[model samples]
Target: MQKRQSAKLQREKGRARRRRRRIRNVGAISRSEVEASTVADPLCLNNGIYLLVRSYNYINILYSTISLLFSVFLFNRPSLSLFILKGKNYFCIVLAAAMSPWRIMMGMIKEKSIRIEKARHVFEAKEEYFIQNGAMLLEKQITCNQGRDTEPIKIFSAKEIQQATNNYDPNLILGSDIATVYKGMLDEREVAIKVKGPTIYCSTELMVDFFLQQVTIKQLISHKNVVRLYGCCLETKIPMLVLEFIRNGTLSDHLHGQRNKIPCQISWLDRVRIATETSYALCHHPTEMFLRHNNLVDYFVLKMRENCILQIVDDVVLSQGSNEDIQAFAELALRCLNNKGDERPSMREVTIELRRILQLVRSRDSKLSNEIGLALT
Candidate 1:
């Protein structure tokens, strides 16, 4: 009786063990199924691709529509009589557009390039400034351009800059663009400081590069018309770009003097001189094609002569230069106002031209003096 009872108890125990094992396996399988079917964040990958494709597709469609319209206008499609005479509906538009004005397309391309550069500076800073390089660099030096640096800069305390500007006085405002520019004296030497928005999440390396670019461009640019950049201040957790004090302010301001002047602040000769100087500065890029001072200046002088110097002068003339010095100065102004960047004269050329105008002014003054002396005798 005892042996029979033992065997029955063992069988019951085995049955319970099997039941527990089965439950454990079922749980493991359920967990695996849940893990396998997990959903991902769809917005980043799929959405980014969709946006890029949509943008490119829209651009293509716009260009195609422009092309079609251009063709229709070129064949003078308004006269259906001509279309019927040609005996082809579509070919006329194509042929007319084939001979379409190229200048429009060139202008579009130039505008596009300008916008692309501007957009890169604006949007990339917000969206992708933190994207780190995932690959190894083979080159020793890489191009870096951040507007300021991580290293401590010689920063002016808010108190000091404020005091320099008479306690953040509005009257001390040097320039008013997106941010207010102030004229302040740091280290007893005056500086024009542009206080803009706070430092963003941009790389320090890029700031260093921007500093270098500002320094290099300022140093290499020999033209008198171009503004010089001093070192920038970035230690305040805010990036402050400092530049050389262009006492006269922008050429635009000088050419078109501000509210204080009831009359034009500059004479026609001065206007001409400024324009010529700016043009010359742009054409200073020395290459085999431009040869530093020759080809572009030549073209600039030629076209300017035809147009005359009257176009660029701002309405207000603050002061008149010697009246006798006006015409030659005007002609020089025309040279500087040439439309093509490459065709514009360099600052050097402008300086030379101004000197010649001065000579002309002196000669006229001398002639007038001679007349006075002879009349007195």
Candidate 2:
């Protein structure tokens, strides 16, 4: 009986020990979670701290080196003995130390300004190429559109069109499968001139109707996100559309790294903004304007609906944004890509949602900046 009682007591003691251990583990887990919640984001915090310290150190070293150089110059110079004897050596050293950093800063600013001007000049040269070729046509077109409520859509003559494209220079061609797009000048503006392929239609009437419909659609769309249609040339055997030149090229060029020797890395914020702007354009006039370049955007929508946004996102942009923002954006894109056309959100709704998302991101960034500032202080 005593042996049985002792064994029971031993088992009860083991259970108590186990219970205490479990309790201790739970407490530790809770404490860790609390710490995590209190800390905004460890990675961001650490990065901020590191940058601040690094910049401070750099500035300190720069000033110290400048001061040392001034001291050496003042003490080593034999020709300035009279000036030094006047009790002005220390004052000269102080001036030199202060002016050195200012001079460096001014030099950097001047270099940056020169670079900016060079870039601007390059862009203007591209624009000038178009202006020089279509000077006469531009004058005529401008005269015709003067009294119009909206920008006048001028119909260019075949000769003017030919001259603008340099007789359809092969080098100026942008795309060439079912249709050909040539970079051209219209009304002193850089324009993309799209000409339909001859094999697209068997009947002349059908081709004419298609071109007319396209012209109508282009004329109707005036959204900022949508590319502007300057006019069309119906005088040619195959009609051509004059569209505004978007200097950055297509989104595909940057996203897929095509035609670009140096791949451009698009950031997460930029990707989101692109998606938002695209959706805004797509749903802007869903019933009226059908995009000529709908294939890429449609493909992206399909991939996003499959929850493949993360898979398709460029590697450079993958690490830059919060996952929550990405997921929310993907969800919104999916909604716009819904199979049921009736269930799809309108352009207005998409615009509102995108604006909200952008605001949220900006607020979060501002909050983080404030927190980092406080931490540094």
Candidate 3:
């Protein structure tokens, strides 16, 4: 009876051990399923976050590109810039509707401000000019007793003229004696300032006539080729005449002075053109008057009659033009010097003839160039 009881106790202990082993296996499987679900949830969350960040980066790049393009377009169109400034509130509303970034809208506002300032400056400058123009007109009527039929000439102050001419420095003298011409700056433009000698202003009456003469000269002539009389300063003991500065010196300088000293020569075509232009200028004078000096046309005619025309032409000029062209040019100069003014060709006729001559010469030159090019090829 004791042996049977011990065997039953051992069988119950084995059943209990088997039940504990099955419970341990089920717990391990459940823990593994829970870990897999946790890993899957984290992976899905990470993917969504990455996609959102990438979309934000793309939107930023697109916004930057659009802002750059719009800035470029606005920079070239000043009227559009002005319009934008005029309608800033409207533009702000439009930008807000488009969901424009804060940075881009701020940049446009700054640009609009700059454009408004620039426009204000321009308007102020124009207003100043109008005021000056009105002053000039008033002064013109006071000085000349003339109506407003002509453009008003400026009346420069004595101090302003002195400042421009550096107190009449001797070194700045362009011509001297009867009237001294000095290089000067007026209104930021280079001008020839001619100050009359005290001899001309010996009496008050003579000074008055001199001033009137200047005004009459300015009013009568308005030719492109003639030297322009800009304005004058009459406050000084001897009045000053502010004339247009010709870069190339006077016709006399080119014909017989400084230009002759140089080895370089003037061409025959240029000489003919010069003569033609001078004749045209003389012919167009308001009054008929012969020049006091031995006329240039007469000198050329004398040379032609003496058969020394070649001597009159520069060595460089003789080589370039045809003898026939030179002879024709001399003959035309002679006819211009006819003793009777009525016999001379009109300025209009002279201009037309010179233009015809120039066209013929150019055509000949072009043909010569083509022949030379063919030979070179």
Candidate 4:
């Protein structure tokens, strides 16, 4: 009876163990299924929705592109001419709406500001040029020399000069070489405008200095034979000189003619007179400034020294002048052209010598005229 009871007890224990094992297996399967469902459900839904949204966006972009292109194509076609015309009023309305009074005023203000800025820069540049060209020096000279009887140096504006020169018309050009001379009218008087030629060889500083020095020297000189300096224009890069205009051509033009041929024959007496007047003008100023040599003068001096001056003498002069007077004149000219500055005679001495030569020529002419008259009678 004890053995049977033990066997039954063992079988009951085995059944209990098997039932616990089955329960554990079922719980594990249920937990795994629940976790998988929870993870996969939202992932699948999200993937599907993402694909739908992406497809919608692509379709929308494609539609917009096609619509824009189609609209442009349609608008460019001839069939749309009437539609465009009909839309003009709407376009005008839209334009008018966009261009409000405030916007218009702002644009105008911007344009005006630009113009003002440009004008200011131009004014500043002109002022700088004025100062650089020795305006202060000129003013001081004028102030120091001021008197009721004295003629002051006038400062000319660029505009006034332009108008006087007819805007530098080509027809108004009197001559052009190193500098251009223009015929103009200023202050109701006929004037000659002298402007430096545009050249790349010179620098601005050198030109400015030259102009200042020229103005200073010329203003101090007052002689009938010398070209009168009326004023100067400093508005340009190089200053412009306003001079008294002579109706007849320049002395050079009169002596040598325009192209090459002698324009007119000036009698020997007139030539001597002109020379005397010129010498007087030179002597009126300091002689030191007039001692500079030029190629023409050097050639003349060489010929004079060689005693071959007759060859270069003008035909009119040779025909009309006395040999004695010519010799004396030549000697005087040689004295004036001496190589040593200190050895050169003073301008006063030159003037006196010229006057003596003139008297000799005049007395000889008078004696000749008397002889001719007596012989004719």
lDDT of each: 0.48, 0.61, 0.60, 0.67
Per-residue CA lDDT of candidate 1, range 1-377, in tens? Answer: 99999999999999999986654333111222222222132232122111101122334335444443443344322211111111112111221212323444766899999999997875555233222211111011123323423222343444455566677667777766544678877777777777642343357555444444454455444455556555444333334555667766565565555554643355555555555555455565542232235665566566555764444433343134453455566565554555566776666776777767756655665787899999999
The residue-level lDDT of candidate 2 at 102 comes to 39
Model 2 residue runs over 4 Å out of place are 1-148, 185-190, 197-210, 217-228, 256-258, 282-284, 287-309, 372-377
User: All candidates' TM-scores?
Assistant: 0.36, 0.47, 0.48, 0.61
Model 3 gets an lDDT of 0.60
Q: Give the better candidate number (2 or 3) by TM-score.
A: 3
Which 10-residue span in candidate 3 carries the lowest summed lDDT?
77-86
For residue 247, give model 3's deviation from the true position in Å: 4.1
Candidate number that wins on TM-score, 1 or 4 = 4
Candidate 4 minimal-lDDT segment of 10 residues: 77-86
Highest-lDDT candidate: 4
Report clash pairs, candidate 2. Answer: none
Which portions of model 4 show Cα errors greater than 4 Å? 1-119, 132-134, 137-148, 152-154, 187-189, 199-230, 258-262, 284-298
Looking at model 3, how many pairs of residues clash? 0
lDDT of 4 by residue, 33-107 (tens): 323333445453222211111122334335433443343233321111001111211221111111123335667
